[model samples]
Target: MLGNQKVVQAFAHEADAQEKFEDINEDLRVWSLKATFFSSITNPATRFVNSLVYASVGIAGAFAAVKGLLSVGQLSSFLSYANQYTKPFNEISGVITELQNALASAARVFELIDEEPEVPEKPDAAVLSNAKGEVSLEHVYFSYNPETALIEDMNLKVRQGQRVAIVGPTGCGKSTVINLLMRFYDVDSGSIQVDGTDVRHMTRQSLRTSYGMVLQETWLKSGTIRENIAYGRPDAAEEEIILAAKEAHAHGFIRRMPEGYDTIISEDGGNLSQGQKQLLCIARVMLCLPPMLILDEATSSIDTRTEIKIQKAFGKMMEGRTSFIVAHRLSTIKEADVILVMRDGHIIEQGTHDSLISQNGFYAQLYNSQFAV
Candidate 1:
């Protein structure tokens, strides 16, 4: 909530957020009070019991001493034993809050551990070795909820090394096409295939390894710059890593850092700007040099000049390799070999950019809408 304060303010939901925060704060306050009451109760009660025991022992010991029935040393020894007996209870009470927190965290961990994998790979699944990058989806049907349909009867085919661009309005299932191809979600019916072999028949690891993906939302682990770039192929040489960064136009900023490639990145690259993080993610893909590429608005965070440079780099990287580009900006996909314009989970039109624009259809209108006078 603190991180996205600007978003809350921008949407004019300050009061709504404040209400939520106050509710959470109230719950926390109640929990803390209960915990403090319980924890605080144990120690004082034990202390009072100890004091009473000491007082009784002292009085009895003094009486006994006066009658020469007990010695001073004997009373002192009994008092020491009492103190030792009560020490552990005090220690345990002090740690009650910590123990509660640990148990709560453990419960959450166990819950995650018990979750079943949605797309489990078969034990005898074939390895997709040296994929030729010929992909096809036939009569695909899928929906997150069974009652509501998303992608219905979708069909697509691409030969080796073809650049296919998917363009559509918001929520038109452009990203769903990428998800199906990647097998992130299994289709309800029909099969998605690569090189004439169904993806379900292949090992998920082998199938995913065939494509290098870069999403609009970049992900980077807490590691040095070099480690993130070489995440896919950890054995990548330093020179190869540098070359990839250079190609992605990330080297300049990376070199300017305090420790260059050795500088540690905060969790999820929090220390870096969004554009810089995207560039690093692109460099990671470049280093991997997979047989296929899936770019979903990969350059959206980048400036126009930087995007142009990255596009040229992408052009080189995509040479003779099958690539799927999911983009919102029509201008960026003008050079695509085939553009698939989707609407409501169906491909309404598929053709080259010039051909689609010449038709003056939905794609043309979308393109013109961006630059309308």
Candidate 2:
């Protein structure tokens, strides 16, 4: 009885094991079937020919050994040898083909890794502290390409918290000034100073942390609306996020979103209108609460109604912070404390809106061409 009971227990265990094996085999079969279908579609001719040759060669060799008048030992040895040779040949062919593909992929990946970074940080760069937004450009010369100069010997200075507007024709390099200030590209000559310290002597990260930038192209990642707003300062509280959004005039539309703050935004915020995307970008910059702000055509893409809302938000954001506005819209910068009119990398005119119009120079011509209507 004891022996019988032990046997029964062992049989039960075996039955359970078989059931588990069958489930796993089913899963493997499903996976293999999908893989085979994909492989057939991708490499139909080669795979089919390889299979056909392997099968035919294996069968023909076996048939010859079995039917031909050969001694048992000789037949066994021949079959074993053929099997060994064919197995390795098949494996080697597959490995060689895969190795070629892997090498090609590795080459492309390594090329990217080998690329020299455009901006190199200094080994002993100083960290910036107590930045009061005083900025100066001393004999600054910059060129995007070696053959073309953008700004040359440009001298400008701004007191702390002063609003400066840069206006110019399409290629006059109005935006280039902001890029230089942010150290996006090093100047070919001269120097840019922030709060009396040369910007180049400060760590890039530390220098940029002092300013917030809003560009024409608003970049929004795919995430919850709150997540997008809180991106600049991740640890920002829920109330703080809401306040920043409200300040940017984004709270109204955000509240109307299907899930409000929890609403998941699409990449580039494609689901939202262009104006709404800009509002969110403004909100993101506002959340950073930097001491200085750069607005590059911030209102260019928005409708008049949305522009009004954004202008109000801009007014709030500009308070107590040094602001730089780069725009082709003359009306947008009319209220700027000082407007610098640039032409072919040269500042042709600099003054308040009324003063520039009185001078009737490049800026006056631009203003009249647009706003004089």
Best TM-score goes to which candidate?
A: 1
* Model 1 C-alpha lDDT per residue in residues 279-335, reported as the tens digit of each score: 999999999989999999999999999999999999999998999998887788888
- Give TM per candidate: 0.76, 0.72
CA lDDT scores, all candidates in order: 0.92, 0.84
Q: Which candidate's lDDT is highest?
A: 1
Residue 49 in candidate 1, Cα distance off native in Å = 21
Residues 1-373 of candidate 2: C-alpha lDDT, one tens digit per residue: 2335567576777676668779999999999898666544544554565667657755666677688755566656765675665565556555554666688899999999999887677788888866789999999999989898789999999988889999988888978898999999898899999988888988998899898988888899999999999988999999999999988888999999899999998896869988788888889998988898899988777777777767777877788788899987777778889899889999999999999999988777888888654
Residue 233 displacement (Å), model 2 = 1.9
Candidate 2 Cα outliers beyond 4 Å, as residue runs: 1-110
Model 1 local distance difference test score: 0.92
